[model samples]
Target: MNRQAQAVVLLLLGGAVIRACFTDLYLNYVKEGLRPFLIAAGVLLVAAAVMTLWYELRPVPRAAATGDGPGQPEARAGGHDDHDHHDHHDDHDHHDHHDGHGHHEPRVGWLLILPVLGLLLVAPPALGSYAAGQAGTALASQQQPSDYPPLPEGDPVRVSVLDYASRALFDKGASIGDRRVQVTGFITAGPDGQPILARMVLSCCAADGRPVKLGMTGNAPAGLADDTWVEVTGRYSDRIGRDAVNDAEIPYLDVESWRQVPAPKQPYE
Candidate 1:
């Protein structure tokens, strides 16, 4: 890649990162708090590209404007009769050494544009059922003893999958007794080939996301597809005896009602 190509690559990368940050696409791959750093990095890269362009466009000094050095006379229009021809040739060579060789051609630098194009054309999706399943059936948070405040005043209290699972597994569902709770998550196939309510929790980014699953037992909508987002209102039940599936119990929910819903902007909690 030449200096011009290098500058283009920098501009492309910087623009892509900045665009992702501005349009909230970065949330799919990283935490929202990284926006400032992404913007800073993009600004630096674009500034560097501008500097490269400036350097490439800068005017080169004319070697013929002044004599080569002390005791040397400028060459004539038709010939170098005013100065020694051999010394003039040497001086021209020295000037070429200083001005002819510009920035290095970037041979492998073109590969740097691939990531920028990828981010621009095809965005990376947020982690979904495939990633969750691959991470195994593990709760992102460990089961621990704690006092959970009373459920907010609502017929069907809205709670996250992680919160429900933590309460069910650790607190023995005491706080969940007879209270109809609503939880939202994508659907995943259970060990018994039944639909399971699943949600992924991320500490920082999708790379660290883990799944929290709850078995659904009720009138699931007809043809409920995998990864279909849904809001299920249900209460904890002891119908299945709560056996462990993948190192974690598939807390059963007696689904009272459910409906399809659009996937949340931030898929992970």
Candidate 2:
């Protein structure tokens, strides 16, 4: 790409990054901790773009001032005139070739504008039920048995889906006991078309996100479409099922009640 086109791409990309970081949009793609770094990088890119544009658009010095004007030929001393003439002819030939082909920038460079436009115009929603359905439950690696702390003091203690799944699967529901816990997450249909409460956990960003799923049973709501956010109050259960995609274990939850809710500001855990 020409320097001008490159600068425009950089400007758009930087603006997109800054916009994402300034709003809750960044949470859809990355961990909250990376916000500052993203903002800094965006600012740097914008600055670089501005500098590039300035350099490209700046006025060029007149040839007369540099003693290279057409009216002012170089005063050759000694017998170097013949060599200068030959050099000038070679320069003219090189310029003819360069002008004929123009600058050869890869066509692929233009493809970058698509993503920039997507980010600026239509930021994609966070990974939801579709992504969850495509991957196995993320609980397998975390299934190693371990001790868990007791549930917090509340009849319906609010807990994250990840925490509840960890306790139910790895700790064997020892900590959950008979307590009714409230968990919030988007719904993804299980292999049997049952509603499963699931949250995506991001170690860094959405590209590395893994789903933590809890199979819903006992009083669970039905007919809800995928990606519907909900708050579910439930007790732990021993029932488990295998993920259709990878046959990973998905622990069950004996849902007491549930209600539709708005998606959270931060979609990932």
Candidate 3:
């Protein structure tokens, strides 16, 4: 293929890969082995785009002067192909786009998406006490921390996911002593750009994962936009709730060091 044609293909693939990465339905649809596949796809797309840009800027070969067929279109002496009078390069020439460039209409993936989207775009009660009671499904823990060496006492400590879940559920933040912990995940924020509490999800393994949010509290780190992976370190504090959870069943962390991080392979726990 010509350099221009090749560049176009690369650009198309890159755009499709990016859309697949960002679109929510794409996230959910390609829900298994998505991290690796998406990452690989992204790298390929980037490489393609770079190659395209390079090719686009590259000088084309000097037109071997066949002097233009007497009946054919030819460039003027100064070298800009004057197409002002030409019908050969018509205004309506078809630029067939590849279907692999995964663009889709605004169709909701699941039927419940309409309501979910409404809740997101507008204000809706957060998934709270109502959901707490229903999310009692069994999750298989792949390995226990006991099998690994314990983190030595330092400025910050390593806490188990089990411990974190329990503390959040029962003691809230009151039970934790003066200890700092670090957790990392993709950033998810509110429309107003507050750091919303979030959870990492898994379909089969920790591969095809996306983040579901909990709630946002206090001022978030400046310049940290949603879906940007970050490493957050802070003290876990409890926020007492109203309703059934009013009896202090809420535990969360007060964020401290929120630094951007690269996406990990097994992004979810």
In the range 114-164, model 1's lDDT, one tens digit per residue, is: 888998999888877777667665653375776776778898999998888
Model 1, global lDDT: 0.78
**Candidate 3 C-alpha RMSD relative to the actual structure:** 14.4
TM-score of each: 0.78, 0.89, 0.37
TM-score of 3: 0.37
Error of 1 at 267 (Å): 1.6
Q: After superposition, how far is residue 246 of candidate 2 from its true place, in Å?
A: 2.1
Is candidate 2 or 3 superior in lDDT? Answer: 2
* Clashing pairs counted in every model: 1, 0, 0
Model 2, 123-203: lDDT tens digits are 999999999988888877764658787888988999999899888888889989999999999988889987888999999
Candidate 2 — what's its lDDT? 0.89
Question: Which candidate number has the best lDDT?
Answer: 2
Model 2 poorest 10 in a row by lDDT: 64-73
Give the residue spans of candidate 2 off by over 4 A.
Answer: 63-74, 77-99, 143-145
Q: Residue 21 lDDT in model 3? A: 57
Model 3 regions lying over 4 Å from their true place:
1-152, 160-165, 190-193, 206-219, 240-250
